[model samples]
Target chain A: MTHTVLVTGVSRHIGARVAGVLAADPDIDRVIGVDTVPPSSLTRGGGGVALGRMEFVRVDLRSPDIAQVIAAADIDTVVHMSLVSAPSKSAGRTYMKEHNVIGTMQLLAACQRSATVRKVVVRSTTAVYGSSSHDPAVFTEDAEPIEVANSGYAKDATEVEAYVRGFARRRPDVSVSALRFANFMGPGVDSPLTRYFAQPVLPTVLGFDPRLQFVHEDDGVEVLRRFAVEDHPGIFNVAGDGVMLLSQCVRRSGRPTVPVPSTAFRVIGDLARGVGRVDFSPEQIALMSYGRAVDSARLVEELDWRPKLTTAAAFDDFLQSRGLFGGMPLTVIDWLATVWGGGMKR
Target chain B: MKHTDTSHDFGEQEPGTAQVIPITAARRRSAGGAGKADVEDRLADLLAFLRRRVAGEYEVDEFGFDPELNDKVLLELIRPLYRHWFRVETLGLENVPDEAGALVVANHSGTVPVDALMLQVALHDDHPAHRPLRLLGADLVYQLPVLGHLSRKSGHTLACPEDADRLMRKGELVGVFPEGFKGVGKPFAERYKLQRFGRGGFVASAIRAQVPIIPCSIVGAEEIYPKIGNLRSIARLFGLPYVPITPLFPWLGPLGLLPLPSKWMIQFGEPVRTDEFDPEEADDPMLVFNLTDQVRELVQQQLNRLRLQRGHAFPPFF
Candidate 1:
């Protein structure tokens, strides 16, 4: 059966890539890419192909116009990828929460009313697990967050996932897939985590080095496209296997780090954000303090697919794109070792 | 007459003894050459290790077990304490499986949980296969900042059933102390008396993973910091189970934190097979209780017998 898919948040990197990939697929007849603003070359980060075949719809999910856009083409699949993690210059926390929470509610409401929509794929976040000391080493999809994210993008994603669950309950016939993606890291992706890593000196929480996982941008888009085109319903964790400690990530990027006490971490984040160095929200700060890793076994078992890169490999790709090496060159280290060894032997 | 007879015997043997000196010198010369090469090889190995650590080029398992770091650094740091300070004597290491996964249920003691570290050192250094013991620590261990990170780097994880089951499924030797803070903080008079085993979570995990349970009894940990009294108010303020009032502690201050030099002995008891029971039986409270009691009893019995054999707290000879 041919699919007429409606993809939200086409203005962003992952959303645009997913729309482009889905539009190129022969199995999908028409891909409707909708966002409040038109997709520009600047936001695409230079690698995505032109999204020529997809139709662009200027519809803010918070408004009632999204329902009309969904109903116009007899769209059978709705892929909601519009959730914003960090506040842009024009938008603040209030608007971001509005776009993420109310926008998702409106989109689901529209999908619920539309008789033709048979599949809904929502791009959620592993932040819903809420990094904390009480968390399991690796979270399965079914594990509830030990400390619920009280604020920020994690809270927004948690609310978005709940709305998706409600939508699934209401529309029993429609297949719903909520992809709880780990932090997206790769070339051509501009995420809060990527911005944090781009800094010259990383300030980390003292005494804490949380385990981190990443899903490469290409894998992220591919997973989104597959879920949009397939019938694998229910929630699934999408992440590259393996985990890297945050300190290890910083060291691998060849950047110096300043250890800040936990109480002072927020102030440091605020100071960094004030200079436009990186977008460090409270949830992101907590994530750096107590890192989160999700088990992607369900993705492999049910979907018969795994990410192409491991967590470390994906981080290395991100580092390569930014022209950062892990540390001092190996040759220099070998030379130093030889000199030191000779001196010690004497 | 006797002196002359002894002189004649020595005189007859002197030339033959002198003939062996050249062969001994040749052997020594080759050994000296190898020793020089060995130093260079060790230096290269140390340099590689430092490079890996600095470049973050090592791998940790899903549960954050860095085998390379654990073997090279963490265990090495504890080896001196295990060998000299505690003078650890390992027994029945043959009871631990050679290859397959096994759960080692040991009694918790030593106010600082140094016993756990010593037990790990013993298994790694003494076992024929030199297996690494993956310890399951309490949440408190992971709640501390530096300690938590180091613990994970050294192949330890939260003392939860999920971690236990996962470690065992991976054919790891998982160590657990079901008594938890109770056994660790008990008074000096109650040293050898086994505290109540926790809600049988370890046994359930062992059954679910179908791994044998090896009862390990570690003596001499209790004497390390003998708790003569408990400062409950101070413990509450610090969020600790107990503020131990040892004879030296709080009286001598920083210097008193040193653990007493007690002779240590770790005895691994017979394996309690869990494969006989179905995995579904893990949910049966009665079976779990019975198995937990059985393991606890085995550990306690061995503790008594080992304590008897250990004799004095600090022995002059083995």
Candidate 2:
């Protein structure tokens, strides 16, 4: 069915790409992109994303006018991707929390009030699972968060998901699909993890090596586009196959790691944040200590789709985009290791 | 032997000795050359392994099981302790399936849970297929700093039904200690006595996955630390199951942390088929409880028989 789609958070790369992709679709009748600012001003990667056949709407989603837009445009699909994962320097934690939680609440409320909205795709995060020692190795959709997110974007995502679930209940006609994405990584995406890797040296929790997964920004946009035009329902985890050890990632990026005690890691993180070098929140700290991985079987089974790039391949792409070089050539390192390890064997 | 004795007794055997010298010398020279060639071949293999690791061309399963790391490094590190320190002897390894998934239910002991490590090494080294055992560790194992990281890298995961079910469904060998901290921290007097299994979660997981339960009994781990006393205050402060006061622990301080060199034996019983029951029976408490009790009894009987055969924890070398 040809339908009108309202895509929020269009200023960012993922949002812009999703909006553009949806607009380019022959099936989608109209794609309305909304954000507080236009796509170019806050866009990171030069030239920004092309809006294509889509129309841009500059307005705060929490404002009552969002409901008016949904009702007036007769939007059939609401794609909510505005939830911020990191606390930006320009915005405080409180603002980010409010923007994520309240903005989601307002958008879902608008969707709930509008009879035209048939499908709601909320871009959720795996952070809702909460990284803790008590967590299962892989979290399925129905798994409870062993460590409840008490603060930061993790908590905000939890509240946002809860609101989306409540909206689904109220508007039984609306098919809600929450895509709990792993850390997004790609050449065009600028996430906290990218910033963390952009640094020359990485400070990590001593004696702890976390396993991390990522979703390429291209995959993120494609997944968003799929949900926007499709009828898949229920929460799904979207991540590339396999996981990379934090140390392995650092090695692959050719960055030196300074292993700090778990307690001192917080101090160093705070110092880095205060210097405006990298954004480090408590949840991110917990993440770096004990990483999170989610099972994307549901997504694959229901949507008949899979990520194009594996975690390692996506990481390599990110490294290349950032111009980071490996420390020693694999051939040389292997030769040295063989000579050394072989000599020891003798 | 007769020639050597005669040569030692008579000085006239010098000429006969001279005739044997060149043959022995030639043999030694060729043996030395072969040793060098063998070393070079091994070095080449090491190079290839290092290359794969450097390029990140290795696979780690969803449960964070680094099979490459476990097979190459972690197991190697534990080998010396298993071969020399514990002198582990394993039996009934043939009972383990060659390829298909099986749940190994073993008794947990050794204040430090060294028994689990020994059991893992036994399965990997002794089993004909050389299957890698994915052990299910308690949350405490994953909560520690170095220990947790190493455990995960070595192919161990948190003791949860989801991980167990996932591992078994993937046709991977999974090991679990139903006793948990209770069996490990019990007093020295209660060493061989089996503790209550936790809620039959492992049984349900095996049933759901349709994997056989391999009852494993480990003897000699009980005497490794000999948990004679517990420092309750210290244990509470550190959030440990127990602060064991072995004879030499607190007295010798850091040196006492070394595990006692006791002979170890691990025996895997015949597979307890879970496929006979319906998968829905996993949710039935009565069936789950009965199966759990039956597995527990099997492990207990094996433990008693093995302990009887072992005679004593530390046997004197003749």
lDDT of 1 by residue, B1-318 (tens): 999999999999999888775433554455686775556556677788877877889887777778888888889888988999998999999999889999999999977789889988888889998898889888887788888888888788888776787789889999999999999988899999999999999999999999999999999999999999889999899898788899899899998898999999999999999999999999999999998999999999999999999999977753
Instruction: Assess every candidate by TM-score.
Output: 0.92, 0.91
Q: Which of the CAPRI classes, incorrect, acceptable, medium or high, describes model 2?
A: acceptable
Model 2, A1-346: lDDT tens digits are: 9489999999888898998899899888999989888898335435777778888888797687799889889999989999888887777788888889889888887888887889999999999999999988999999999778899888999999888888888888889999999999999888888989998889898888899999888888888888888899899999999898887788677777889888887887789788875876788889999998889989888879889998888888999998986667675876687666656445
Fraction of native contacts, model 2: 0.59
Instruction: Please provide, for model 1 over A156-249, each residue's C-alpha lDDT reduced to its tens digit, 9 standing for 90 to 100.
Output: 9999998899889988999999999999998888988898899888888899878899989888988888888889999999999899988678
The ten-residue window of minimal lDDT in model 2 chain A covers A41-50
> What's the C-alpha lDDT at position B134 in model 1?
89
| Cα distance off (Å), candidate 1, residue B136 | 1.8
Task: Flag clash pairs in model 2.
Answer: none
Stretches of candidate 1 off by over 4 Å are A42-49, A328-332, A338-346, B1-32
Give me the runs in candidate 2 sitting further than 4 Å from their true place: A41-46, A328-346, B1-33
Model 2 over residues B1-318: C-alpha lDDT tens digits?
Answer: 999888777877777777675433454466676776556556667777776776666777666778888888999998999999989999999999999999999999888888988888998888899888899999988889989988998888998888888889989999999999999988889988999999999999999999999999999899889888999999899888789999889999999999998888999999999999999889999999999999999999999999998876888851
List iRMS (one decimal) for every candidate: 2.7, 3.6
